[model samples]
Target: MSRPRPGAGAALLFDMDGLLLDTERPVFEVFVEEARALGLEDAESFGLSMVGLSSSICQRLLRDYLPAEIGLERFRERWDAGVRARLAGGIPLKPGVAEVLERLTGAGWSMVVVTSTRTVTARSHLGEAGLLDHFLDVVGGDAVPANKPDPAPYLIGAERAGAHSRDCLAFEDSDAGVASALAAGCEVHQIPDIRPPDRPVPQRGQAVHRTLTDAVAAAGLLV
Candidate 1:
């Protein structure tokens, strides 16, 4: 795999869930509990499939398993309320995240957070983490007409950062995000969470890293 350096004027983009925040496991636990309550036996698998996708997309993905009486809108509201209560404490940051962010900021890279989380939730989470100041802007899941696995979100992120997509380094933790960033023409690094991608990698111009620390190291950001 080729290790790309962040040269002058290069930008950085990040995915929120699972990648920067340690929210996936706990959030998925809530998902499982909700699904079981709704009498869906494949809750675990369903939860896994929803990783890295926006709530809107997850709703569609889960439509088939939803009980007809409950309906999509009501199911979403109840599930969101459950997850929100569970996450009321705070979202935890991934290991070495602050160090990497500090180093990258010191090196003068413009940064943006491009996430599949809705704008309201994304803002709340980042503000709670005190990480909002680290980014120049945020492109939320609702900001684009399409979500991950589509290039729109990442493309918009690059545009908002005022950098060409090819000059940006996108960090993500799932195959969906990887595909999005790659399609947008960024040099992407995937740091797997929960499990490795079912698809083979390098994934065109993207590379897989063991962790965010490894990604920062390879990017030579500490220099």
Candidate 2:
């Protein structure tokens, strides 16, 4: 692997959905739209709750959204369409994404993406945002057996970047992502998109940010 850019020490592993693109809202929107067919509102709320898990795991966890008489495959079909439309409209990077990434890239930070999202979906978001070139390597959900909260993704990301797990910085927007990176022994920062219902303080040990730019700025990724 190529050397990471200056100042950041080694690698920076970025989450694909909420980190690279504003996918959380739109993803839940798709869920809500699909749930509407089954007479469920607030799909976005319930959907967002499953943000960091693998899609299949999330689907299983949310199976109750579908009527027993109806197969989950149908719900998936509808949800897929909704998501495609949202992505087609484009999902912009969170505030400061460009500034932080540009600064880091210029400074020679080796960067890659490790996401619990399918490559097809990942490509749609990052490609549309015109940020695909920024990643030196990508590990999509479909490419891995274990997902976020498992540590496998982060470990693979660090390995691919040719960096020590502890030497890498991971940017995440979900609890699962934070846990995964932490389990792999990487330093983590969280760009909180939404507060949980039970945890008033959100999760701990994470450098919380209102946006990716803020987190990066705090980490001095701009250097």
lDDT of 1 by residue, 57-131 (tens): 887877877878878888777777887887788778888887888777777778999999988888889889878
* Candidate models: Cα lDDT each: 0.84, 0.79
* TM-score of each candidate structure, all chains considered together: 0.90, 0.88
**TM-score (C-alpha, index-matched) for candidate 1:** 0.90
After the best TM-score superposition of candidate 1, give how far the Cα of residue 48 lies from its true spot, in angstroms: 1.1
Model 1: pairs clashing at backbone N, Cα or C within 3 Å: none
Off by over 4 Å in 2: 1-9, 41-45, 196-201
RMSD of each: 2.5, 3.4
Q: Which candidate ranks first by lDDT, i.e. highest?
A: 1
